[model samples]
Target: MIRGVRGAITIQENSEKEIIQATDRLLHKMIDENQIMPEYVASVFISVTDDITDAFPAKVLRSLEGWSYVPVMCMKEISVSNALEKCIRVMMHVNTAKSQQEINHVYLEDAVVLRPDLASK
Candidate 1:
């Protein structure tokens, strides 16, 4: 079976260093929480708020030790009237046996406000 693991984090600024670091942190957390391996990942979809333009979050994932081959794409999040800023969101598709309820979605830093319920799960 295939499953989608979701995660989101907010960066302090729009610098490339901040984007890469936050994305790297969030990805690792998601992987650790779900016990995911790069080989089992089908693809990763990342979206960043419009304020984040310094870099693409995919760069961090692709540079991981065994994640060079994992498919990754990055996009800009839709602009809402009063939405969160400097946020990065990821949806990773993976081949796994876990059921939907067993999956642990991750939300970190300021992004936690975006999904308070999942943040504690």
Candidate 2:
């Protein structure tokens, strides 16, 4: 079955390299920790806080992971009051044997506060 997996991270800086590296780390960890196969991923949608415009997080993921065939898109996150800053979030849809409850969602750095329960899991 194809299901969505959520993951997020906060960039320490606004630099392109920092944003890209942070996204790469967060996504890789999410997939590895969940035992997700890269080939099974259908597509990915990434949203970044307004502070992050140096580069698109989805593009960086494809570049770093050699996921050239995976479809990816970028969007801006809703700037809610007191929201985490410099954050990049991902929703990856993939085919997996695990059910939704068994899927792992990663929340790294300052973004971990967004979903304390999932982070603890």
Q: Indicate which candidate wins on lDDT.
A: 1
Kindly list the per-residue Cα lDDT of model 2 for residues 1-121, writing each as its tens digit: 9999999999888998898789889988988888876789899999999989888787677775658888889999998998899999999999988988899999999998999999888
Candidate 1 structure quality by residue, lDDT tens digits, 2-108? 99999999988889999999999999999999999999999999999999999989999988899999999999899999899999999999999999989999999
Cα lDDT listed for each candidate: 0.94, 0.88
Worst 10 residues of 2 by lDDT: 57-66
TM-score of each: 0.96, 0.93
Residue 60 displacement (Å), model 1: 0.6
Candidate 2 regions off by >4 Å?
Answer: none
